[model samples]
Every structure is written in C-alpha cells, then in structure tokens.
Target: MSRIQGPEPERRLARLFRSLAPAERETLLAFAEFLAQRGATTPEPHGGLREPIPVPRPTTESVVAAIKRLSKAYEMLDRGPMLNETSALMSAHVLQGRPANEVIDDLEALFARHYRDYRAKHLSEG
Candidate 1:
C-alpha cells in the first residue's frame, strides 16, 4: 500500500502512478473497477444498493514492493507465541499420513529455521 502523506488524495495518487510500468497501471485499473462495483452493489438496510465508494488500487509494482516489505516485517515481529499459533494453522495443510515426528521436523526446518533466516536478512534493511 502507498504511504499516507500530506497531499490531497488525487494528487498523491497521480504521483504514485507516474513511475509505475504499463502492466502495473493496468492491474491497478482492474482492481479499482472491481472495488467500485463491489461498493455499488453492497446491500443496504432497506434492501437497496448503497452508493458507490470508489477505491484506488496501488500500482502493481508498488503493491509487489509493499508486499515484500511487509512480509519481512511480519517475519521479524513474528516469534515465540505468535509463531507457534501460525505454525499450528499451517501444519493442517501438510500431508495427512505423515508421522508426528516427521511433521515436527518439517515444521521446525521450514517454518522455524526459515523464519530465523528471514529475520536476520531483513532486520537491518527493514
């Protein structure tokens, strides 16, 4: 997501797209249209459509960059109790027939070790 700044929203949005690639612009347009339609068709208390509220999508280049940035932050802050909860959620997707010890090893190597590295790589940069 684009960071909030002091400028008016329209001007900020214009500035944001100035550096985006063509494909990024197209993706943002599509997402904007989808959001507009979603807002327009929302059910009202009286059983009618609500007024449309348009939302702009961030450029794909910016969006991808933002995701990468946030992913690193999430990995950094996520340790101990928080990571344990997330591990339980992800473990459900593992092969059902796997033995308990095998699952433990897989989780330790994939989630724990990788997260340790993820933090080390991003701690200074982020």
Candidate 2:
C-alpha cells in the first residue's frame, strides 16, 4: 500500500499563515472558521458579481493549471472557503496519484457551484 499522506496540509497552511500580513492573516483565519461552520457553503468577500470571463480549458491541463484557470474565470467568487476542498484535491492528485483529468473535473464543478451561489446571492439582493 502507498504510504499515508499526512500533516502536509497543516504545514502548508502554517506557511501560508506566516506569509500573510496581520489583517490578511485574520481574514484567512476567519474564512477557515466560516468553512468549519458552514461546510461547503462559501461566502464571497465584499464585491460585485459579474459574468465569468470565458477561459476555455486547454485540451490538456495539469490540476494546478486548471485551478488557476478556474480562479481567473470566476474571479468574483472568493477563494478562501474553497481552499480546503481545493487543497484536498491537489493533495489527492499529487500524493495519491489520482488522475489529473478527474481532479480537474471536480475542480471545474467546484468553481461553477461557487459562481452559481455568488450570482444567486448578489442578484437576489440587488
């Protein structure tokens, strides 16, 4: 069996926390708590929603590149809450040898779902 992948995420998260400025660090911590409270439901940072820029996926993409593309495409959606899920998928592919294509598929769906929630929340309020 493959060796267990463990504590890598925590280490990465600690590094990210250390790199952020104090206020930014607080924001990140708050976002993490929000995810803990709400599970998969992500909240947007104060902003307006707009049409996603169409970034056509390349016929070939690594999971990392696909994530970058989706983030650009759905720029309105906050990345904070999605971090947990995204990192999990990244670790799955990088550590467990999960196929890149499958990870990208789920990543696309995750971004799309966040975009939909963004639109619904903003459109309904305005």
Candidate 3:
C-alpha cells in the first residue's frame, strides 16, 4: 500500500513559518500544543529540560562583550521591544552587585521564559 500525502505539504515549512504574522504565529503554536498533548505519555529522554548551567564568576569584560553581540543581533532583527536595553537594563542587572552564578541564573531564566512563552503562545493558538 502507498502512503497518502496531504495536498498542502510542508516542503517549504521554514519559509512558511517566517512569513507568519503574530496572530498566525499564535495559531501555529496552538497546533503544536495539540500535538504535544497527543504525545504527552512519552517522556523526554533527559530529565525534563531545564535552564542552562551558570559558570562560576563570569568576567565583566566577557559579559559586556556578550551584551554587545546580543544587542547587534536584536537590532538587526528589528526587535527592540523585548531587547531589554542591553547596557542599562538586562545586562546591567547581571553585572551589578551580584555573584557571577546568580547573574547567569537570572539571565538564563529570563531567556528561557521568554522563548517558552513565545513558542507556547503561537503553537497553542487556535
């Protein structure tokens, strides 16, 4: 027997994903949520995925350099709203009066939450 294929195939799925506006993004996310629920019984191989591990005592220069790179990327994407004002906002909080590990923890959490929310909002939209 031959496998049946849908007329609207996923040949250019990547391009399709990028072309979606915010509302379309949400609807796609909704579909992903439906699929995830269907497979909920299966466990992930690793202990549930978690935040990135923080290195002990990151150097100020290294953190600043990272901020610079992130800022550049954020600008190029024209995504200033969530960009977190590199120096005065997000990175500053990380670099100021905090243990290196704590800073790393906070930054990692920030990124993870933002990404998760973005994905879920789109994948779960009806």
lDDT of each: 0.41, 0.74, 0.42
> Total backbone clashes of model 3?
7
Worst 10 residues of 3 by lDDT: 71-80
Instruction: Highest lDDT: give the candidate number.
Output: 2
lDDT of 1 by residue, 9-109 (tens): 87877887787788556545544443333234223355322221223323332332322232333332334333344334333433244344444344434
Models ranked on TM-score: 2, 3, 1
Question: lDDT score, residue 100, model 1?
Answer: 41
- How do the residues 36-123 of candidate 2 rate in per-residue lDDT, one tens digit apiece? 4343323445655587889999999877667767876776667777888987887687668899899999999998898888799889
Error of 2 at 23 (Å): 32
lDDT tens string, model 3, 1-126?
885477555556657878988645654554444333333333324523323333333355333333333333222222333344322333344435544445445544554455466456545752
TM-score of each: 0.29, 0.63, 0.33
In terms of TM-score, which candidate is strongest? 2
Worst 10 residues of 1 by lDDT: 48-57
Clashes of each: 0, 0, 7
